[model samples]
Target: MNRTDLGPQRIVCLTEETTEWLYLLGQQHRIVGISGYTVRPPQARHEKPKVSAFLSAKIDKILALQPDHVFGFSDLQADIAAALVRAGVAVTVFNQRSVDDIVAVLWQVAALVGCTQAAQRWIEAVHAQHAAMRQAVQQRVQRGARRPRVYFEEWDDPPITAIRWVSELIDIAGGEDIFPERACQPLAKDRVLADPLEVVRRAPDIIVGSWCGKKFRPERVAARPGWQDIPAVRQGHLFEVKSADILQPGPAALTDGVAQLHRIVLAWMDGQVAAVLGQGGVAQAGGCHA
Candidate 1:
């Protein structure tokens, strides 16, 4: 369909990343509604009316808006999409589970809106940025000395770890994620650490939390039982990376999340060496045995 004839002049986005991507591609005029939780770009909140939330939506309200298309993310949104579809509104759900999948979804969305050329250029630019960042991280790892084990917490109640894209970002940043095996699982239950002692056993050198739309409580994490013995806690390596910066599964995650990971890992590595030299007057520190 032509950009003018795509029948999506009134669109509703169920997630922040899709809304942000459409805005970036100059398709904001087509968006009629957005998620209540969208904070990215800042302008989206002011521009679009909030009609839905992640995993749940006001179906009647969305229908009243007369949106021709509804955009949602994941199986979590399947019901929302089905409801809209049953009401004769077209819906597209993206279930991107990896960094590559996210980029591909962006392209697909752009294509749906007849902005394929713009999407191609945008993808190329992001790919170039990723390559350059990867190279820089590799150089830093080779020269600056060490790689740390990172434990990335996506939630804390049941203790969920990083998802696939987040784990990949950690790898790109020159750090190894402690729960790499669980990264591919989409459900929180699959990624949750059943035993708090598992975290203690992993003994990560850095613990980063991004509690999925909630503010991470590092102090709360630091106070967990048996966590006092974890090296990350002892060295004050516990940190909070905002959910917007990492959990979005789009350009924001690639840019801001990877940068945050690199900064934290590099700082932790430097701190370890500094601590050893300060204590023993020697630069040698058995450099990141992880």
Candidate 2:
């Protein structure tokens, strides 16, 4: 088949997920422009002209690229999409909030470019990986491993909690999200902890911070007033998951992000068991004395 005969021969990806997906689909040739924030398939930055950031774009530069189609994410990009649409450029803005939505968007993008079968195979592989992780968690629970309470910080200043997909991943990774109710809110503002002390009250056993592009500072978190008493703080159970890994709301989140979460949970469980044994208690296979 002639390459141009497929839909959207020349495309612009305004987000990392679509760009990463196209690359994984062996359709990178179609991408003429990409987001500056793209780091997943790092070579995309060197190979494609960066025409957009997360919330802003160089409209004239994007137009110069003459992309037949532009892919973006979320209502946050509405203005950019509108500008491009007014200029006679086709745009698709996907708002995928959960793991299922991410998978669906992956299929939609693939099918649009005549790669449905390829996408199907990739989706199957993703499902298998997810299943393996779930099985591991189930076995751990069956062995009487206590699931730790996890508090995932998306932003530090206002202390926003995990999104829906992240909370779901934590559950699948053998940890309970402390602010699961906040995860249900799609908007970051809606998930904001009006009082940061609420996190102290929640007393998460593990704290994972991915402060959206900024490095996570454990000391700063530990120093928060009254936070010292939290189990995670007292036990030094704080960790960092990079924004690019867990905050992307795409394949990266499903794969690398979830894997990291699982590792963190498993390590914590092992530590709990060791703590019990060190205290002269018999280490029970199905339960931790600590």
Candidate 3:
């Protein structure tokens, strides 16, 4: 189908990533609705009517829009997808679980919107950046340097580790995630450290918190009992990465989030080396507290 004649003319995106991706690919004209939580591109939240939220939607309002296609993600959005399907509205739900899955979904969405060439170009550019970053990380790893043990907290109520894509980026950035094996789990509770004290046990060299949609409070994290004993806290290695930058299942995660992870890890690793060599006091790694 030609871009002008693509099947979907009026689309509702139930997630931020897809909405942002569509806009980036110059297909925003087709979008009629978006999630209320979308803030990546900013203008989307202002221009498009919000018909849905993360795991809920106003079915009547969405149906009223008469969208030709509705885009959603994961089992979290399964109910919304079912409701639209029952209403005889076409919907495509992407259940991407990893970084690679996210990239594939980008291509698939572009194809669905008849913007395959645009998607390819965008993908190539991201891939080039990823390649360069990966090489730089590998070089740092090969220089007889110890990879920092990173603890990525996705939530604090029960303490959750990083998701698959975040974990992958940590590895690519030359750091080993504390809960590397649990990276693929979807729910935060599943990745939670049952003991809460396990974080102390792991002795992570760096701590990065995203805290989903809320602003991360380093002081709160540092005040946890026994947490002060952890190397990351004692050495001031705690950092906050915003959810939009690292947790989004889209190009922003791969580009902005991964790059942030790389920079943080690199700085941490460099600090450790510098301290061991008696060059100066421990290096302080910076983070976006937003």
Q: Which number leads on lDDT?
A: 2
lDDT of each: 0.78, 0.82, 0.80
The per-prediction CA RMSD against the true structure, in angstroms, equals 7.5, 7.8, 5.2
lDDT of 1 by residue, 153-231 (tens): 8778889888999999888777899999999887767888889899999999888877776666678998999999999
Model 1, residue pairs in steric clash: none
Which predicted model would earn the best TM-score? 2
lDDT digits (tens) for residues 7-119 of candidate 2: 99999999888888999888999999998888878898899998887879999999999989999888889999999999999999999888888899998888888888888
Model 3, poorest ten-residue lDDT window? 280-289
The 10 consecutive residues of candidate 1 with the worst lDDT sum are 281-290
Model 1 regions lying over 4 Å from their true place = 1-7, 272-290
The clash numbers for all candidates, in the given order, read: 0, 2, 0
Cα lDDT tens digits for candidate 3, 118-158: 89888998888888877776777688767889999978888
Q: For model 1, what is the alpha-carbon lDDT of residue 243?
A: 79
- The best-first sequence of candidates by TM-score reads 2, 3, 1
**Per-residue lDDT for 109 in model 1?**
86
lDDT for predicted candidate 2 compared with the true structure:
0.82
